[model samples]
Target: MSTIEQPRPATSPSADWWRQAVVYQIYPRSFADLDGNGIGDLRGVTSRVPYLRELGVDAVWLSPFYPSALADGGYDVDDYRDVDPRIGTLADFDEMTAALHAAGIRVIVDIVPNHSSDRHAFFRAALAAPAGSPERDRYIFRDGLGENGELPPADWTAAFGGPAWEPVGDGQWYLHTFAREQPDFNWDHPDVREEFLTTLRFWSDRGVDGFRVDVAHLLLKDLPETLPSRAELAAMDRTSGTHPLEDRDEVQDVYATWREVFDSYDPPRIAVAEAWVATPERRARYAAPTSLGQAFNFDLLTADFDAGQFRRIVTENLAQSAAAGSSSTWVLSNHDVTRHATRYGLPPLAGREGKQGVEWMLAGAPADGVDRELGARRARAATLFLLGLPGSTYLYQGEELGLPEVGDLPGDRRQDPAYHRSLDQGTWTYDGLGRDGCRVPLPWRASGASLGFGEGAEPQPPHLPQPDWFAEYAVEVEDGDPDSSLTLYREALRLRRELQAAETLEWVETGSEDVLRFRRPNGWEVVTNFGGEPAELPAGRVVLASRRLDGTLPGATTVWLAP
Candidate 1:
């Protein structure tokens, strides 16, 4: 009964095409605007397939573009079966999918199963229906405490910065681990589980290559009585240890069911989890053969810009993924956090741990003493080092042009719920809590009404403003510059495909501890110098260097060598 035509058997490099693939993450609203609406849509995305293809990424992982009221920036889903009208329709998505496929790039859509927009039909019905009705059962609704039911049922805090419970007018409250407008689904309910399965198939039948499961670690939670205090939760180590609301063992069961659905197709679909669990071992569980195919390994993303830290994390990540019988995932930047260029420029904070690293980077005053040129140099070196590794790599949009976080975004134009929640709770200041800095629209051209993001004169202004300096890094400006970051990324990706056949990596001992040298099975070696001085390159012909070299790998630079 599916309207989609059966896909041709994949002519991909291998059945496990995800392995060794370089995937680009595209935030739809900011990518391009084909309709002159200022917001990037599926048509805009379709028009850019060739750009991505030429960029050398093997796949594109689009952020949520589903129907929503724009709460939490489309993470709040009102309907799972269709696209938001602001972005495009189902037909537009289909067209984009076909275009990407024709360009030999896989399409991985974002799926938010942990919660639904309060405006979703089921959530709306639950609000209007009386307490104890089945409509209410689809979500986690509970009775409030105290004499007038004024107090919340639990002490858990929202990830966005407020109480996790939101009261519905009828003396009952619903759980929302994030913004209040996004009501958490009761995964324990058969109806909720069945609905997600149907939604998964709805897209699968439409020929999406795979899905990226958002907040994959938070599908299950302990009973309300067992919820921990905010302080205790904050102090908990996500790298290890159990949490009432995160990385619960029961969540694997959910993915096991999803795995069955994924395998039903001829080529079998793939899925990667946005799971932020403690320990690489625990993170690997989500990528086990019977569960999701891959889980994002953020060890590299969270590691300090130190040689020892990067080496240790890379070793740990690879070992854990090997134990899980899955390939590891590497990523530098994503929409939710500061771009790596800016992060590298800022001094590392002491005692900062997982997820806190994001906050630490955001809260720090970059204006006081950030060396952006140094950050760009290091980021470029890191990109070559990341691509040289033996696994999948995810590139955030605009990183190719070395975009730095726009830390000075005006408060009024901010959109992240975290920013508003912080103000409402009298917690952190709004200056760093919001994520608008990293979500600014890409500047496609050096100059235009909207930097060539939208077509024609009188094009709509972007949802966010592009800084004047954006013109310096625009795609058109860097397109022909051989030394530009965009050129470096394209060349690195091209060379990566040629050098990626090697499945094993062996560490090469360098005299200095600050230098990391690794040799691939294919006689290709990657050396990164993180010390105060230049390091002698390994005895081989230089294939590519992050920056110009004078017969030595400069400090904060990386080079790929062919023996």
Candidate 2:
């Protein structure tokens, strides 16, 4: 159950409040910097409690802020129980939690159980111990294939790029599904499982309302004696659990156990899985009532700004989650992907597995690769459509300000390990940008060192440089604009709290394939026009809209109507 206060309705708010909530994701380092360190810390988050409350979100999901070398943007966490001194301390974290709770906002922290930073004590110990030592058993260390054990054990590739195995300069190799700095834990080891449960309770006791399980679909790999081709594994269905690395069947037992630890607390803590399974059905498995209880539906994230695709994703995800006795989740953008504002601007790429445009995304705005205005309009429409749905919604930081992807960020300043790894391997799979474009520090003010992100009297350059164009999307500028994306998000969140009392979604066929319409049990209607022509407004009062609405809803627009 969500511990935050909700608008009282006929339904009990204390029961499964996350089923219909607005959760804002705060990437700490980019959110706001305090102490002139050019790195956002816990104090900055605590100071922003008022802004969060004003945004009308029920909860905030903070990305990992633990001690790290920033190898993978803090996803490579060195410790689970404490904050990075560069960011803040454990006391700072406690204060942030208290402030958000005082403001009636629940807190959910990121947890990476799939892997551990090479700097983590366990990983360090494993590295120091002999190849056959117990410390090495804590992680997935194996013998190499070559006679000298120089070559990697298998042909498995890292999700980022290159070989997934890293040699310890000894006779053995260790598996790291991501960057070499993050070593995948051996879940078969009892100590590894116990340590995670203890870590969960540690933060829960400190008042974290929930957790966001990083790479939830990846755990408990099935290491076959005979390694399979990476291409063959890629072609296999993720739901089948036959792929040696992802969505393994044994991972279910782990969540079932985690559910027990979660329920032990009064007003039991909740968790949402960042699972990227092949289908809604596979994703739903991670959110089963006895599991995490919530998982992201990313189909919509990569979907083109089309009406039919949105409807199908909603229908499939909702039905699947409901069948699993869990609430659905809708997300447009996050730290890992291009922001929707830039994504919707790029034309759809057909031969790429229904993925949205990317060839243009890496082009960095040469000639006319991006249609920014069109993307923004579609993004606003798509967001409203997402908010009108009957489940929780995740809004990435800076998304409220309509921040476009910083695709042109200089190569020297790029910090994403995925980008460097791909480049080093000569793969350049993400066109050399990787995830850095969307992970840029947010712009708060029109001008200043780091765009007013720091509270220090002396300005400090942000860890990542903010572009000059960011001034147009600064929160300080948009906050006062009535038609700004910030305004749209604030109003939409506020009204959704007021009208989204029912979980049932009824389709309102608009007689056109390009137009999508749906109604709630409370007589509220959400309609979007993807067609070239304007869609006639249904018989209801215009409550709110992505753009100003008239007698009819214009193309690339979404509007909410009152009974």
What RMSD, rounded to one decimal, does every model reach?
4.6, 3.3
**Residue 214 miss distance in model 2 (angstroms):** 0.7
Best prediction by lDDT: 1
Q: Which stretches of candidate 2 lie over 4 Å from their true place?
A: 1-13, 235-237, 351-367
Q: Candidate 2, after superposition: displacement of residue 122 in Å?
A: 0.9
lDDT of each: 0.85, 0.84
Q: What is the lDDT of residue 17 in candidate 2?
A: 71
Task: Estimate candidate 1's alpha-carbon lDDT, on a 0 to 1 scale.
Answer: 0.85
TM-score of 2: 0.95
For model 1, the stretches where C-alpha displacement exceeds 4 angstroms are 1-13, 224-243, 351-366, 429-431
Query: TM-score of predicted model 1?
Result: 0.94
- Estimated TM-score per prediction? 0.94, 0.95
> Candidate 1 residues 419-477, lDDT tens each?
78777886653333677778889999989888988876588989888888888899989
